[model samples]
Target: MNCLIIDDEPLAIDIIAAHCAHHSDIKVIDTCCMAMEAFQALHQYEIDLIFLDINMPVVSGLNFLKSLKEPPAVILTTAYPDYALEGYELNVVDYLLKPISLERFNMAIDKVRQRLALPKPAVADTASVRNLSAAQSGPVKNFIFIKSNGKLVKLDFSDIHYIEGMKDYLKIYTHDKVHVIHQTMKNMEEQLPESLFRRVHKSYIIALNAIKQIDGNCIETEKGGVPLSSTYRDALLKTIEK
Candidate 1:
């Protein structure tokens, strides 16, 4: 993936570029010392991700990001943690507090790759649309492709034990491995088949067959106990009875 690093500090730019060099998949297309130079770079190249500093002279990074109607995946790098919430609010892929460690930098890039890999929603034009019959379509799919460690990994529905939500990411628990994915809980709920999975809490989704017991406000699974919210308790019970 092509990357653009934007920072006022020469050292900061060099540090990020050095880190980018470690990843074979990441190509450092250009580094800009200011927002205007960064703007020119954006027009000149096809950048997949941007390493941006939150605090810069004249125009702040967040303000620069606001100007773009559609931006490539952004990872905010800053000395201050105050703008972290604001950065995530702007839909940045990840927030890295400087001085950024190589491990942390790798984590951020993984998120960027995943965000770039996510399928874009199709825009249909009725004038040029083609119709397909039901008989021509294939059978139902029982697996889903999730971005894990910068690659799309196919996972079967039956292997999912449960899912736990972080602020802007999800921990998908399978029988043996836990996959971290950049996605919202609402989007995951919509994508998962309702018959196999159920949201037991705002932060938890348990596979119906994976539930060993529903003890009080907790749902037990082989992995661990998940909190059951009152809002979804009735619905879970109703589904189980059916």
Candidate 2:
């Protein structure tokens, strides 16, 4: 999908462009620093999606969108939370706040993809429903963003070895280094994809593919060993068997 970025701030434009560079499906065709420039770009290229900043000089993003006869899918970017309601009223695909995380940006892109692929209003059939279900489960995201040390850290599922839970904080063991973040084991477990991670113990969650061996109640990863509780061992075994 071709994307156009419209933001007055150069840093904001750079951030969005950097995030767009990560997605193989999105191609950023043009970037505009002003609403007028964006209007010109719209006429020049076939834009499928837009990353629009809400507060800008002259015409606001919402006003510019309203002026367009048929605006493309827009994901509003803003520092203020006050514009959220107004942005939604314009039927934007998603709303992203300033200093957007890669994970959140990817989610917004996914929403744009889903919206663009939607069929017109019609009676749903069994086959169509099945196809929709398949589309919704198209592919699992390969990475996640973890907030640690006052910044968002992106980690690929493959790079994670295991996670050890401490009181009020969790330690994530990865290929290169360990990240200590203020998070609960349950919350971390919920965030990770079940296909890649498993809750082996109340205090541990290990990447399924990272498990080198399982000896009795201990699961060994490349980094270190994690205790596998009897409560979750059977479920882990079931998954491995499948």
Could you say which candidate leads in TM-score?
2
lDDT per residue as tens, model 2, 64-179 = 98999899999999878898888898999999986676678878888997999943234356455434433433455577777678676778889999999996688999999999
Cα miss at 162, model 1 (Å)?
51
TM-score, one value per model = 0.49, 0.50
Candidate with maximal lDDT: 2
Candidate-wise lDDT, in order: 0.79, 0.81
Clashing pairs in 1: none
